[model samples]
Target: MTFKNAFMITLTAGSILASHLTQAGSPVHITVKNLSDQEMYYQSTSAMTQAHASPTPELLIKGKGSDEFRVTNPALPDVTTASLRYTIGNKTCEFRTSYIRTIAPGGLFSGKLNTAPKWDKKAISSGNATCTVTVTSTNFSDHSWSVVFTMK
Candidate 1:
């Protein structure tokens, strides 16, 4: 090869090696939003807040589908029912839930959490009920994602 061509090839090879030796690019990030209603319920039923107790702040992810949701939460205490209460206009609405997350720390359980939500304007007003969601976590860890939901 000609001297110029040879020099160009050598330069190209050196640059390629240098480029490969370097690391680059931005990192992937996961953002968690507290899309949770920034409200609180002092007196309630059918649902509880994530800050109620230890193993609390149980994250509830609401979504839509026939596929059952499965999560592990040991803090859930035994309860006949649990729910999430909200007020759409003057009407009181609730989402009844049931869960089968493993009770023992690290243990995994599976079941349906009250898959259906309930909305009763009278239930909320007559019962003097506040907006809330009920749940039972035998383990009671603050990291339980007890319920999952999707925004409309």
Candidate 2:
């Protein structure tokens, strides 16, 4: 084969392999929007235990504003559900949510969380709220997530 032809073939093969790896899956982006008149404090973290735990810092979003958290790994399983804990005013609530969008490989999904915390006068107030969400992607990787929001 001619040198030019051989080089072109090799390049094409390499491109195909690279595309498969990179296009295996798209990153996961979770968005939380504050619809109430009150401002909200929030944090997003991985519920699963990894070699290095994902850092989750507290954040605040003003009314009508939105914030996003992203997790990426094509090899990681698709997250079908997420746990959310939040406090509205003086009431604290914790609940598991299955409202995540179905994200296909090399595709993107955006899910909205607008559930207000329910009133419960039973459990003693610890001043802290927590929830455990379950996430399993296509690759069979399982991840637990905690996304907490509190009214400010």
Clashes of each: 39, 6
- TM-score: model 1 vs. ground truth: 0.23
lDDT of 1 by residue, 42-126 (tens): 2334333222333333233222211122322223322222333443233344444443323343324554343222211112232
What clash count does candidate 2 reach?
6
lDDT of 2 at 59: 58
For model 1, the superposed segments whose C-alpha errors exceed 4 Å read 1-43, 46-81, 101-146, 150-152
lDDT of 2 at 4: 100
Q: Find the candidate with the highest TM-score and give its number.
A: 2
Q: What does candidate 2's lDDT look like per residue over 1-152, in tens digits?
A: 99999999999999977776563222333445455576665434335311112233235667767565543443333323333345546544443333223434432334543322121111122244322222333222333332432222
Task: Please give the lDDT score for candidate 2.
Answer: 0.41
Q: Lowest summed lDDT over 10 consecutive residues: which window, candidate 2?
A: 116-125
The list of candidate 2 runs beyond 4 A from truth reads 1-26, 43-46, 49-58, 73-75, 78-81, 91-152
